[model samples]
Target: MDTLVLRLQPGDDLRAALDAVLKTDGIGGAAFVVSGIGSLRGAGIRFAGAETATRIEGDLEILTLAGTLSPDGSHLHLSVSDAAGRVSGGHAAPGCVVRTTAEILVAVLPEWRFSREPDPQTGYAELVPRRRSSQTL
Candidate 1:
């Protein structure tokens, strides 16, 4: 596994930036967000069982961020605290705009490939991890 540390500037979209990392040359086909913390002007979080994300507006601090990254897509979860110290956590969605800076640590798995496939049991596309034939531990 290879490690990557990223710093996102103000106005950057948290999810979009992370997505772009996968497209970078030599990054590999799969990664895991080991840790992340940052500040956001606002964020969009999809709560449990909710079909759509709820937009949260304010000076928010990202308390936690972690998840899987795949070529097909990513599944991330985050927790944030508002200026008032109110906390909210849910599935991380796009449109989370950075306020100050976002520091992220990712572990790139070069020997593995991750894809999203429809699962009959969950009725949703889920992560499918596989080893790369050309690589070995």
Candidate 2:
């Protein structure tokens, strides 16, 4: 297991930075263990049990970020606040922009793999794991 520390500066796209890390590192599978305190210019998030997403265009502060990564796609959950500290969060999707800066700590998990596939019962994309041998020949 390894951890990649990221420091995003002003005018940088927050989500884009993380995605870039994954693409650059070729991290097909991993999980975010810790995120940092930072500010964003604009953000878009959707709550659970909802279809349409809402956009918040203002000074946004990332309070917390939790999620997993996989080859299929990265499953991310996030929460943020405005200048007043009013909080709103949900499944990490597209259109989440950054304002000032954001510092993040994304953990990389090796050997173990994560993926999202269709779930017949729930009709939602769920996380699934792949098994690998611990022993060497």
Best by lDDT: 1
Off by over 4 Å in 1: 135-137
lDDT of candidate 1 over 19-48, digit per residue (tens): 888899989889999999999999999999
Instruction: Give all candidates' CA lDDT scores.
Output: 0.94, 0.73
Per-residue alpha-carbon lDDT of candidate 2 for residues 2-30, written as tens digits (9 for 90 to 100): 78887788877666666566566555464
By summed lDDT, the worst window of 10 consecutive residues in model 2 runs over: 24-33
Where model 2 places Cα greater than 4 Å from the true spot, the runs are 25-28, 134-137
Q: Candidate 1 has which clashing residue pairs, if any?
A: none
Can you give the TM-score per candidate against the true fold? 0.96, 0.85
